[model samples]
Target chain A: MSNKYRDKKTGITRREILKVLGVSALSYGFLGASSKVYSKSTAHIVIVGGGIGGATAAKYLRLLNADVKITIVEPKSQYIFCPGSNEVIPGWITLEDLMVTYTTLKTHYRINVIQDKAQSINFDKKQLKLEGGDTLTYHKLIVSPGPTHHYEGIEGFNKELAEGAFPSAYSAGKQTMNLRNQILSMKKGGTIIISSPEDPYRCPPAPYERASYIATMLKDNNPTAKLLILDSKDDFIFSNNYLVYWEKHFGYGKADSMIEWVSKKKGGNVVKLDASIRAVITSNGDIHKGDVINIIPPEKAASFALQNNLAEGDWCPVDFFDFSSLLHDDVYVVGDSIEGDPMPKTGYIASNQARVVVQAINDELHGREVGSPFIINDCVAMAGQDYGMALAETFRYAGKGKKLGERYHILGAEKNKGKQIVRQQVAENWQRTFRKDVFE
Target chain B: MNKYLLRLFFILSSIGFSNSALADDDLTGGLSLKENFELAKKFPMPSPWLLSAQCSACHGTLGTAFNEIIPPLAGMDKQEFIKKMQEYKTADASNFIVMGIIAQPITDEEIEAMAGFFAKLKPEPLNQEKIPRDVVVPEWAVMNKESE
Candidate 1:
């Protein structure tokens, strides 16, 4: 009773003071916790192009950060992979097999799919302009627009010729299908000429792969048809390996063989193509007549990239970490459109870059530092049925230099019968797994 | 009357302090969500000049031209370039020797710089004069169709 009277005369009790302090501390903690939770739930990332790079990026971004809002803008309704396109030329696979849609990507990964081409990007405004007159505001933009064929350099070769006489099935679409149809319909003894272009084109091994597939087709279907490869360079990067495979599969080196590779050293470099006459004039003043001519002319950035002012000289420059555009910081460029040393313009590389970009964006969104990134790529070219050769390497960035980590070669020649079977299995598994990784 | 007024004022101040403390606790609990969301929305943009300086060494000043060895960067495919550089780092199949070497030392950040440099470059016609037309294609034999 005495204590109570004294406390009443005094101001407050110890328990009450503690209760007030606890409530204040708890309120501050809750506020900090809620902000963190809300921040992680609302990250928006926009990717341009629906190719391997962009699609992979969209998928992986979701995987890395499930809370992210991912939007992919592309012109095409479906994506046709260029990786396994050689099989199409030989009629081993159809165009339907190569086609993939964003619907599957969207349904499986919760990605937003927009079927429209990006016309321009306002870096300062952090907005992207679409050809449909719509603008999208994004926190980060990843551009993966592919290449454009240069048809002006070659004399008498343009879009019309590409549709009819000379088809550069570089871009995987109707043009690819048309080229396949043309090759299949050629006469038994008709001459087929495949021309290689100057450097900085898509798929370094593609031309050779195309030649191999065509030669295989000719050998099996039309033994009398001759396939001529007129190369622009003296020697290609994988010349030895490709030639070895050619010799083993096609009766290469024999005069009666179906395939003939004409390198620049052999004076068979083509300077001009007379599409009307179906003749290819070489630099040595020689004329070669062909029933089918596949001329891969010079290439530059895609038309949309140039029109949008995203191009520097011939290519788009971007930041390596997030694949953001250098000219326009808000927009990030991936795949073949941006410049990267040591990395080839291959689908696998694009996919790898996509993963890196997605990771960086997610980390940035989370207010976390991006860890060291490791990018790896491998290119496997099918020489014949059940026969494949591959090249692989890994890279890391070191200030101004790109440090090489490891390089590997996978060939089917060194293995025993049992091992060969395993290697084949590995190759098949790789294709299936890779397809799922990118498309599924 | 003065004593009664003082007591009233004291009671009101105590009540006001308690309410503010409750409100602050509520705000603190929800702080991270709003702040983090804002940070995610505000991504840092890279400097264009930094990217250009790096690209000029290989792609030439403003991506004009270095030599026939290196293709002009102007009007190049942004996706293709990025993809190619990634290949070089990972050993994806490519023809250029320098790309693999150049990409070896690059970071995703540096790749971004290079991409940014080319993205800003103006499109130009390829100077094809230096392109060697005399390079030979090895396997073709001058065949007379009439004789065959």
Candidate 2:
């Protein structure tokens, strides 16, 4: 009814309008009888964050419905993928190798990419207020801002210390290069401490992979140097594989072993950091000093989700059937921000969550019932360049208000060198193809 | 003015002709084509499309993978896909890196549905231009690129 939407030059007359209405009505009847047809509604779906979840939602939604207006609000113009970033430490892959841009999303998918930070959300108005003072009204909103690293989780360990001396290279940006430089330039016989956080964090196997990669770097660069992993959790995802690799390559169990892991049960849970002395204090009041410290801080839902009341305590809760936020009706949350237990916070899971949400939205637009969500996470991890392991976790929806039922299958470390090498090659190829699938 | 009105009339009338004609014969359960379509629209479960989409992470969207090691599933023969999946599901654990495990949870009905879904899609070859300039495409992958 607005003048902006009207054809000004043609100036539609009443007779013409009536004719169009009558014809369209008849066309709708014929099309409805013949096929399942969904008309183009002026629905604008606004997504926050341009990580795997948001990007996948935008692209997949466009695939399901060609006419819905999709807009993504993210601060960064380029996203450095975190999946293969562990290889960056050992110089096998560079940061640029994991970098992806929004060019394909904009040009090919015709998605509106607003390189602006989302400030807050007005739930009642269904409008997203941006930091640049622009408010975008949306029919539905998806928030996938990833996790916010809670640096204060460890006393005396803050963001400033993380960026300055001790780098928690969790998100694969400047800190990743920083950690790599520290490892390359450390003293001979020096110790590099990696304080791993507890469960319910992003990439459950990342800290161990980081240790393995750094061990490889030290074995070549500083042969006498030591790598210590202080885990807040008693066990990790790929401990069996990592142990075998470390024992074979670095003499993990020997008295003069190059790499050592102290689990929380063994008083390895770091409670505080004495940054001035480059030491971490464990739960039992033991102080361990290192030449370089990489403390991966605990994480919570992103700040935007917290500010807008999309989260409950630490993470946002959602109906697993469609990943719609439990707090807000028209808003949905996905990725590391959600309370998706049994589903490790991985990019593959995030992409699938996006697919479920988009499919639900598309079905609702067509007046169809939202279908069940079946998510499969095929996680491929590497202990070293030659040895790789993979796990397949399937998450099935139980019902409303219940957690997704999960079944996990992970093979132990490969004993055969040929099979291990092939698996490594498969893992490497999967990273490249995954990048293309999400971005291109 | 007369020409504009005539053009509008043609455009309006053509809207009904855009789609192909549906079969007039009654389908299974003795339902007409429209009734069957309605029944399908109301079907509570749609696990096939949802299940097949999760494979996009490693297999590429709709299984059109460009990686040399991971075989693309789009345009694969339905019977072949079903057989391969069943083999992986029941084969020795060491035979496959992850496919054996990944295929275990899916039911046979879901497998057939997924097979049919992927079989209908035409596989597309990788567009070399879409490959980022800095990425090092493996020699095997580059050599194995199929013509469109």
Candidate 3:
């Protein structure tokens, strides 16, 4: 094979020397002494998680380099995207519509798809141990084991409860369907309580979007029903847009409004979920009961990163230059797992971070300096099918040991009906295009 | 002594990087000595391909969009792409919404590099047989001779 994959050693090998000499002589004969030679590499890149970040890493890595072996270790064969999953709650979209398979990554890109869970990482040996007891060695590793929902963060709420009555449809899966079915079957004029968690969570605008969409669903089916959003944080992303939409449609801020939002200052931080009584206890000891409860739990770096000592507190710290893990060399952490602030946790940012990491690894394999990273997050959120909003954020690499500098601009909620409809359509188009970009 | 010399060689080699390398200085105007030194210590600017890849999230892969709410960028006229991007970057808030803000942080040279990249790409055809969706072009995104 190619000399680009020559194993690292203290001195150059004889074959490499001979290859260089042959290249130089051939260049001298063909053109001149100025021609430089580059070749394909045999380096193996192993990625954890098969969500947006992991899938994008596999796809984009193939685009940048053809010879390097890329493998993705994901337990599920198909992924249900969380971007448009909020639409599943109101029957605007189905879970099947958001599902994507790894078949394209395998057949088109020739990537190795290992349908197995990543057990742990052996940093010393640079090996990732899979749940099936297979060990895969890699020249570089990318870990994007998306965020873990700590359902226990709210006392009395556990995984079983989430699967049953109080469905936290944060991750778009069975819980998403459960939440939707709960809303559909609730008694007329029944109350639905959606407990939104604090900051630094995946898709910051999702919980609010879920609230808005569910409000629309209620307006159509259960007109007299109430939807209360108890938020842990004081305010949320796209608050202006969501608030404006809520007021116009759901009679928000009125005496007999269909929808009401309780911020943390107003005793909305849900500390406990009393499943026995179908009530949630706020931090201020206020008990609010509901017929349907959807608790979006607080989050932390996935268990894979936490157990392997890749996390510092709740997230993994990464060098902004390439998203290489600060704790381990030759290892990278992207997506919601990294301590990426000044950069919110969103799928768009995660995919962009994956692109940066692969470029860095490809550069290093080619014996070149890894490039500085610039990330852009074009966050698109919809308050309704006809109303959408967007935020543009750009992060620039500052230096070694410094967070990437950030600039963000968000448009105020659109007042023009035509613009709002167009933005909504654009958001819809983006979801379909983004899904194909990563998986297909 | 040899290690230091090798380090110096890499730093110096980075300065006059070839077109294939796509160094920041090679694409952009140029970097100051201080900026170059900072780069020498860490990493140089990312490739233009990586910068443009960010658009695919909304604009479609390589700007070959299946729908037309947002205009595709693949096979766009080089100068035309540059002009629109420059307009978006320099235009007031009322001119556009998200693209203007997104274009603000990106350097003009980066935009030029991106424009050059999209100009060369051949956009993939929409497989209408598989993806049966209607295309609706927005008013603001409509191309005109004056804008070009």
Best by TM-score, which number? Answer: 2
DockQ of the candidate models in sequence: 0.01, 0.16, 0.15
TM-score of candidate 1 chain A against the true chain A:
0.85
User: What residue pairs clash in candidate 2, if any at all?
Assistant: none
List, residue by residue over A1-440, the lDDT tens digit for candidate 1.
Answer: 23221123223342343243334434545576531232444445778888878887887777667665677889877677677776667766655656566655665576767788888877655567889876766667788888878876677788777866578787765667677767778987999998887676787888987888888878777789998988877876456556776787777899877888888778768889887799988888789899888888877777767777788988887666556677765567788876665566877678777776776776777788764444556565656555554544444443323322333332323222322233233333345445545766
TM-score of chain A of each: 0.85, 0.91, 0.91
What value does DockQ give for candidate 3? 0.15
Q: Please provide the root mean square deviation of candidate 3 (C-alpha atoms, Å).
A: 14.3
Candidate 2 per-residue C-alpha lDDT over B33-99 given as tens digits, one digit per residue, 9 for 90 to 100: 2442343344344567787888888888878875556768999999999998887766442244777
Candidate 3 local distance difference test against the native: 0.79
Candidate 1 residue A290 Cα shift, in angstroms, is: 1.0
Candidate 3 interface RMSD to the true structure: 15.5
- The whole-model C-alpha lDDT of candidate 2 against the native structure comes to 0.79
Model 2, span A1-440: residue lDDT tens: 24322223344532343244335534545665421243545566889999999999999998888767678999987888889998877778777778888877776676778889999998865678999877776668999999999999999999998887989999988788778878877989999999999989999999998899899888877889998899899998878688988999999999999999999999999999998898999999999999999999999999999999999999999998899999988799999999998688999999999999999988888887888787888888898888888877777776679787677766677665656666687788889888889989
> Second chain only: TM-score per model?
0.44, 0.54, 0.54
Model 1 chain A worst lDDT window (10 residues): A1-10
Cα deviation of A153, candidate 1, in Å: 3.7
| Docking class for candidate 2 | incorrect
Q: Mind sharing the TM-score for model 3? A: 0.83
